[model samples]
Target: MARSLLAGHRLQHELESAVDIVSRASRMAREIQKRYCDATQTVGDATTLAKADASPVTIADLAVQALILGELHMLFPEDRFVAEETSSSVQDERMEGAIRTWLTQYSTRGVDERVRDSIDLGSDAGGCRGRIWVLDPVDGTKGFLRNQQFCIALALLVDGLAELGVLGCPNLSAAQEAERIASGYTEGIEGEKCLTIVNGTDGCVFFAARGAGAYMQSLTDRREQALPQQIHVNANTDPSWAVMAESVESGHSSHSLTGKMIRILGIRQRLGVDSQCKYGLLSRGEACVFLRFPRPGYVENIWDHAAGTVVLTEAGGRVTDALGGELDFSHGRKLPNVRGIVATNGHMHPAVLAAVKHVLAEDVTSG
Candidate 1:
């Protein structure tokens, strides 16, 4: 009994520390967006470049990563980390200076070495043996640039299974969302209308522990709502009335395949957004399903879905590959074993899985 109590205490302490670190990182990202990503600009004024995979990397990505990893190092120096952004992505002197400027907001350490070391802390190769912290400093950069939906995702994996997850959706309005849900406005609501009507504000932080359920709080809440409102997936079991959520970027997922699956399942309402905010929406029962069938040969990164997966599952939702395989995150930083991603409120997961297989099988036969 003593051992069990001690273990529970330790888990609670770790979760509290994680929430603090992620909240600080989220605030820093919001500041950067306000400064650089205004209405006049599509992409933030921050310097941008392409990675080896041809994906966009911006100053906020590096800065938020540095802030989160740096804080984690201070809190738990022994833990390993895997993240998406790297110091090498910052090439020019001006960009380096921009990163340095952001670093000063978080710490008083030396600018040059601090920035590089903090970002490089994420270079560790993760495996199934010990504790690892996975981070996506800024997921959905295109959404961030356009001032749309984007998130700062963080997760802790113990022995390769996600035990804690935190996501900061800068465009999500928690108070408004609760009001909408309470009013039974779950269908035929435009995504933009949801954003504008509910608080006209951005910023919500959702988090979960392995066994404990998922919960959310507003970033702008100065008083820190004493107890976060617990969240759960929708209870609707009928497939015909389900609402689907997918990425707004067609390049990230196969639109044709998703369309076919939607039709097959008789889903009529669809919401499109950028980032793992889809997972946030699902957790709060704002959407019933999330489907992402990445293009052929595109491997899903662990950081992209790890935090979101835990958040959804803890909120009475289920996530797996399109073929119903568990997402394998033990190999390294990438989910080499996952072919595609599917998420839904628990009730409809099996039905959704059937539709996924049917659509893919049709593709195989037609090809």
Candidate 2:
């Protein structure tokens, strides 16, 4: 029924169009990804590269945002876009120069005036009315800098809800297994392994519309012309056997608290990764749960989780705030009304969320 609804929705055509757009943007970003990671000379050696050279991530971020917004705007002139990068915040002339050369060399459609000019498309204050596009051009700068895991997240929202989502993971591969996640990645790049992860050269794309279910496909390789494979959350009813996916950076989520929650829930396995690709991981059954508890006073930007929500939910998973509140995407750019985030396969959500609530409540009471 959901698959049929994916085609029936008024926005289905737009969703279909986005698969190609996101795939192209993802490949373009991969070009910049190589340069960004190569700056470190050796992978995972953050000390080797100076902060001054770190602007390539920004270059990729801004350029990709522009490319997506530019092409989408031309196609849907009346649609508004709310993206992550803006001209006011772009103070790096060197980065601007970098994008000019980068886009000229790597962009599939070639560099155009409107691409850079569309940088401020983020200025629009989106709300729950009509159709709007939300995008995080480059979701994990750290992951990109390290050449590990990163994604280009884009979504189409109608009346404040994400109906279509496209997650372009330039590092994730379509060949995934939950066993590696359960035991721990011991074998690929930089010591910690991702047997199914792609290098900077090629990647995968995960996409879905609300009622259409989720799908994963290969990216950057034209000869394959591979058909997308439908995906689903794993049926891991026991929390003890569950594998959780979380942020690679402890700063983004409180790992100490996460440790407590997983321990309480009997989940022994965890795979720390960057960006919204965690959503893809869950949707494709590589991982069973995802949890994040931001520091107090922190609110998530819409672009951070918008695309991820649809991908996971459509794959028979569930998403809600820490207290199990439905995620609210109507209040412009930030999820001001929501706190934290929890995602799991439908069978695991109830147990995992119960544990999350108990641990958090205990922490609050102790504080």
Count of residue pairs whose backbone atoms collide, per candidate: 1, 0
- Regions more than 4 Å wrong, model 1: 1-8, 39-41, 44-46, 107-113, 176-200, 224-227
* Model 2 agreement with the true structure over 1-367: per-residue lDDT tens digits: 1233366776767876687778878888887667556645344232122334343345677778877887787778899999877764445565566656656655455456644577887677989998899999889877787777889999999899898899999877666662243223322223222222334345788888888788888885765644678899999877666777888776788777777777777776678888999999999887898999888888899999999999999999999998888887889999986767999987888888888889888988999
Q: List the residue pairs that clash in candidate 2.
A: none
| Clashing residue pairs found in predicted model 1 | 170-203
Report the lDDT of model 2 for residue 264.
78
Per-residue alpha-carbon lDDT of candidate 1 for residues 1-367, written as tens digits (9 for 90 to 100): 1122224654676677677667767777777877777665456445567889787778889988887888788878799999998889978778878877777775533334567788999998998989999999999887777666789999999999998889988767776343232222223332222111122374788888878788887777566542467789999877666768787677888667887887788786666777998999999988899999888788888999999999999999999998888786788999986877999998899988999999999998998
Residue 303 in candidate 1, Cα distance off native in Å? 0.3
